[model samples]
Target chain A: MVHRISLVGETFVFQDLKHILASASLLRSGDELAGIAARDPVERVAAREVLANLPLRHFLTEAIVPYETDEVTRLIMDSHDEAAFTPISHMTVGQFRDWLLSYAADTSSLEKLSPGLTPEMVAAVSKLMRNQDLVSVGRKMRVVSAFRNTQGLPARLGSRLQPNHPTDDPDGISAALLDGLLLGAGDAVLGINPASDHIGRGMDILWRFDDIRQRFDMPVQSCLLTHVTNTITMIEKGAPVDLVFQSIAGSEQANSGFGISLGILSEAWQAARELNRGTVGTNVMYFETGQGSALSSGTHHGVDQQTMEVRAYAVARVYSPLLVNTVVGFIGPEYLYDGKQIIRAGLEDHFCGKLLGLPMGCDVCYTNHAETDQDDMDTLMMLLTAAGVNFLIAVPGGDDVMLSYQSLSYHDILTLRSVFGVRPAPEFEAWLERMALVDGTRLRMNQPYALPNFRAGS
Target chain B: MSQLAQDPWGPLRRYTHARIGLPRTGDSIAGSEVRALQAAHACARRAVHACLDPAKLAVGDSFIEVRSQAKDRSEFVRRPDLGRRLDGPSIALLKQIAPAGPWDVVLVAADGLSAVAVERQAPPLQNAVRAALAHTWRIAPLVVAHNARVALGDEIGALLGVRCVVMMIGERPGLSVSDSLSLYMTWNPHVGRQDSERNCISNIHARGLSTGEGCHKLCWLLKSARKLGYTGVALKDESTNMTLLPETKTP
Candidate 1:
């Protein structure tokens, strides 16, 4: 029998034996799609059809802003009054949409059109906004973001460097490359990021501490700082700060390596030790996106890059010594995730950069979004854990972040009980209980509560 | 002799025999090793101590000796614990140097994990503290602690009866670098007390927290803590009163 078939670049007319040859050629050249050129109309038509179906905006959007609004909603619902209406009524949909589109793509306005943004969505939006502002400040401050990851395994190390290493033991080479990198810039660098927002639902978890800060007149420099301080206060006042960071994304920062905030924290810790002759508590923490707003022209708004960098550097230097754990990074609002997958990817991007080396450094991916996907939270945890990120955070709502966090805490205990035949579920349960209290609210260590009244004046 | 055995950069066995099993040095080797160790120790020590003084210090100030025994009451090199627990003579000296109690703030600089870090970082930290204190308008006593941690500031604050306490201590020796310093602050100074009750400033070394920036930050933290009436993890420093100055302006 004779057969005639056309591929992207050429047409082949073959007898029975040649048909076998064509099949083999197709199998060998499958990945050459990118390099292939359509020579005939049918091939061109087939290629165009295939290419048209491919999602391009999806890829870019996924990379830039990886958050799910529905997930954020679930988290808010889980931890806070789900029926609570957000103050979206204060701003017109156009205003909100304009504000969102200022940093994000046109599709980012999807949730704004929904009109009635759940408290969860509001929280998620608020958090994403705060992170955007914080990153702006960091850029302005010229604060060099430093990081280390907790992947400890060889493969991740290889992926960081010599990504195309053909050897089976490429990760070992990656580690060596990292070692060399640190050896050169050792003294100049700080610690890694420990995303401590994983403790309970972030905003829901944070509300208790925020309320306390209001009651105690605590300044609102950084939400992480507030949480740390509140946690410490609770410990001092006979509540365990340990519960504040239990399960979820809490351990990512506290576990070991310095994340964005944790790196600065290590610096602060050193400063505290040197100036105050003190030691941080046993429960270490890493917070992300603190001190979002600052005074510019006598108005409170998000900080610019230089101001944020200066402040971040100042905080890093001042607080280095007291670091029980280090935190680092500044994710912008463009990467905000209210009910999308972009939030997780954005967090991963930061995690990949900030948590390049260190024992505890993990993707304790943090976002200020009130609403998020519970599934995404789990997916982030799973993805990050698989990618060497074990910690994550989300406010309690219908959003996935909160759902994932709450679920992960129980999941952790359940996994431990099932795999290791141990029952640490009480610890997770206790953590949830403590998170429900005002005094025991702070999520991370070495961070303080930021009250509404407090403002970064400079 | 066999050629492989005699070869200098031969296979694994020969190299191991030539290097690992061999004791190549005598007094000179020992001297070199000691020199290297001392050099490392001095690097950390000087970085920390330099934080204390900005001026081109005289030879005597920089020349610290790690002696086997104490030379005088001021000698902290010989006794690490003595640095931790003030000697009777040292305590007497502190009493004479310090002002009357019940101050608004107290600053202490201690040689914690690495004395080298303390020597190098202290001067700049002190200078920064002075500047920050000036702006905040508070009474402070800058004390040099031989051995201490972040909480030691609270201890001194309690003894001195100050409103708040700020302490600067050495950071743990990291593999990447040594000689890093840290700062801690508290609303009330108490021994073995609250962890979150205090705030911190850290990495006050050339490589970590630079002195000029560290000092300004310290002042900001202290001022904020004082204004807020609390510090540690819960304290928030949202005050934007800080003014940036050129390097030449700071003296």
Candidate 2:
């Protein structure tokens, strides 16, 4: 159907829903690169004007990537709840935005409405929203997921202790891991991005991490960020697997680019569940997603990157992941351009993920080549925490040597926790007190701190 | 550097390059840490925006210079499509350099995201790769294009009618690493190739993968891509650190 709108004297024509979604998005480099962005600023508002009147049910009727060819699309359609959508069925995209920001969409209401919302519906409403609107609505939605620790609870912030090393050195990882723990940074998990996918190397890292996790009796889970297939093999070999990690995408084709499928993911999810590693809850999947991944893989099927990003949450929602985050600014200037765009993208991803019933986090990072810096990350971090995101990835001094990208530092996370008056996961916070790293959200002063001890074995 | 100039874990930080256990003031890092990051950002800005010093690279008549459609650094950074194809005059120049050829591979050295990487590392990597693959492949003269991306190699190779393209370009700079380089090899080089249709060897720098090792891997991939008649998913990097291993003395 031809979607058209007029602004002043100009008449704007859009090809379809996908085209309108791309045009209606705020300025970002990825949409422009896809050649689907509005020709000018006014045309963008015009596209949004047309999109505003679109009935909420239009997203359910017109599949963005097509339902037949894509498994992610199939999963979304198959899992949607007609009963839950009835409350907002009559609202247009504009009306839906007002509804989300109004008093009617409370904590329980959003939770019940989550299953009925498709990525497209949330994405459309999000594009109509301002940053404060995103924050106001996103902050109200509480999506608590648990493995060994509860995350995304009200008045709490979670963090992943990313102890990534260039050579998968145990001593190096241990050093960073110790640094993270002292700053109260690993409430979500102590995750490592191993340099290589060698199975022996993966199992070695896992065992070393498990040793620290066990000796401290820390409530935190541990993961080696390798491919899911490698983790599955390690699981078979009796390695202490806590979370099965993979970089997932919105499109089935792009997931294949990562060499994953719903079938493979199901197998890994069930396998991890069978191990019964969690002391608190049973969510066993950890996923990292980013905008432009599908486009980067050349399999976006003409959908905008923002919509593509939301679709990935659909895939993540099916598995009930303990944690899900977008490596937002790490995709670089081609996708996000600069600090302003990166900040907006981070908030949007958080809002969309929260709305779709997933525990969302943001890496809040940028490459040196990108025209952004620590100041921008500071803004985004404060925004995400205010929006009540589940977690943030904290590494040593915000520099990931293995990945070679800058993210939030342990100190930065501490600052955020201090400013927001939010604590770590309840169980992990108890462990922090037990270890005497902190005296009720304050770092223990002048106390002789004992760092972690690694058993002398690989 | 005023108070707590010394980190308690300073000795253990040698285990990794990651900056750990920074001195803290309340919940924030001290001034020196902030200054260090600013210094890195400045270095990286120079790496990305500074003009290439091709003279420092020591190229001769065998190397031809060209420009992508992107006229400047800002446009090049923003418009990737412009960086992936050569300008009209540049295409004419490439055609003039080699009117027609059945070369095995064409080597392209592009000043991608970081021109500093190309200025510092390209000469060593390009020379080593050419010398190593001289026997097995009929390689073309190095094509140095400014304001270019990895896909720029495709159009250059297609115009030269080469079977494969080995692209040595600057990777996006990390905070502490502004000059790390990367190499991408693609078979049947063309204008619109998916990233999956290539094999990438990244993180080549002073502290990362060495030029010698990068050359070895590229040569191996070239040979494998020829045997398999493809480059991307079907072919795998079965490379190891055998070159760095201590040579067993043959008694």
Candidate 3:
């Protein structure tokens, strides 16, 4: 009786099997592995040589070895120096794919693979995947856990507080914050664009929010949405800087308009890290971007708005920011003319940012001069909610008096939560529950919520 | 890294209202500079929303207060076209108040973007121009249009049947200066005139081009526009060595 070997059911076949065999010094006389043209002959010779040189336990029974199988397996095994690879090296690509799919189907398996796999490896393997496979891999890697357990890229929402009073008074700002919190907004972060660009005023606002959070034991974090340099000053001055915020543009020139470069952003990030005020781990940066900013600043590099926007995402990824929002319709009529254009841009930005492994959010907003209204925002917000966006801007009454534009209001947040059955971040939800701002799944809007005891004058 | 490092751009900042040479703490701008910018921003927003009190304008009893097609400030901001025409009552009032003749110029004051600019700078600017052209030009009665845009002046001038119209309106608020008035002079002022047919003199705030200097520039531009038979790109200001007055900062 003659024993025969066949090459089938292999997940990965090493193309330079002969070279690997040579490197391993595992060849026998009269092998002539390279000249063997016949498929069956090649498989029989390769498998016999590999089986003779390596222990039987090295090869999985389900897989068929077609190349310098032992040498390839050895390389994969040794690759575990950086990250453990013992469990994955013997498995073929098909087997690994099945295992990943099964793990994704049950997130409990996330820890099982966490110790052995790197984000880079997952990113590399993601290229060969399609649809659900890619999505499953992305879902596992996107949630940055530096800030309290975000639980890997779950949908969240936040608001921009334009507590802009005619007079830059603290009482008015505190009122706005209380109003939004009562309405169950600011889950993502409490970001403020101060009416005065003065550092002292910025510091004052930061301190006020910090005091509010401490007094009320609120789970939310705060940021003064000003120039990076100004924010750096606030941080140095012992202000409670949770997230250092800046407006980022795709081109260098536009960033220069905001007085920022990658270096400046890194500096701000370092400052925030040093301050370490956020309850959520040290991922402390908030960035806002618009499409036409680059073109308006004369630094677009002739790229289309969408491409430029994605490039901005690349920049955001470098810092691993806690919040990255794109102010879709806020730029003006020239770039994203109407509701249709604005909606498409918002969806595209969200999709690209998510695809690039960033926690993405949309500003579902429009300027007063834009040929759009609340209905347009409604459509975009619904679509973004369905798309599993991380957050949306929650302004008072959906109108930003300082920016002179309309944005997603506190009411919009309630609508989204009710319609989508989504809640705020875990910590925020717990805080809201404890404060009785929410009853079960519903926001307690009709009930009177207690104001924080910290008075501005006091 | 010295605390005594002299600001390199401090002297240049005195020359312009543009945010320049703001103090830096490390690589970032100082809190004082940031505060100044924020203050400017607040001023600008206030300027935009400020009410235009026609009574406070004090242009004279001969000037009649009128409304544009825009019913309110919100509507004026949303539908700019509505703000460019006179409302029915305003048209009737203009017809009733002004004598229909070939007046040399119709001076119209509008609260465009900044009511503070209209309230603070318009009266002084109008007075200077009026004084400069006292004996030469036959000026029509001033018309103060509420919730009005620049082109509204064209309709008012056409109703008064003037050859030229000088519209002293509020310029858009800048982060540096909010109470800035602008003069838009149009030759052969009438309905259906494009913005290209008008000449603009902007930054006429107390700090910028003063009422006197703006008045001189307007007089020169208006006289040239009248002579050249056009006001826009074809006309230019030829006033020599025009000295800017000391900037009077507005609160």
**Each model's DockQ score:** 0.01, 0.53, 0.02
Give the Å shift of residue B121 in candidate 2: 2.4
A355 in model 1: Cα distance from truth in Å? Answer: 36
Candidates ranked, most accurate by TM-score first? 2, 3, 1
Answer with 1 or 3, whichever has the higher TM-score. Answer: 3
Q: Give per-residue CA lDDT, model 1, range A127-245, as digits (tens).
A: 22333432231111111111121212221111110101112122222222122111111111112112343333333323433343235332111122334433444334433121222
lDDT of 3 by residue, B59-141 (tens): 55768788888787656664566788899988988787666555788788899888889899887777766777878999777
lDDT tens string, model 2, A285-388?
99999988888778999999999999999999989999998999989787889999999999999999999999999999998767888999999999999999
Candidate 1 lDDT by residue in tens digits, B92-189: 55455446544677666565555556666666566556665665556654566644545445546665667877666776443234667777777766
Model 1 chain A lowest lDDT segment of ten: A157-166
Native contacts kept (model 1): 0.00
- Tell how far residue A191 is off in model 3, in angstroms: 0.9
Alpha-carbon RMSD of each model: 30.2, 4.1, 20.5
DockQ, model 3, C-alpha based: 0.02
Chain B TM-scores across candidates: 0.60, 0.90, 0.84
Predicted complex 2: DockQ = 0.53
CAPRI band of model 2?
medium
Candidate order by decreasing DockQ:
2, 3, 1
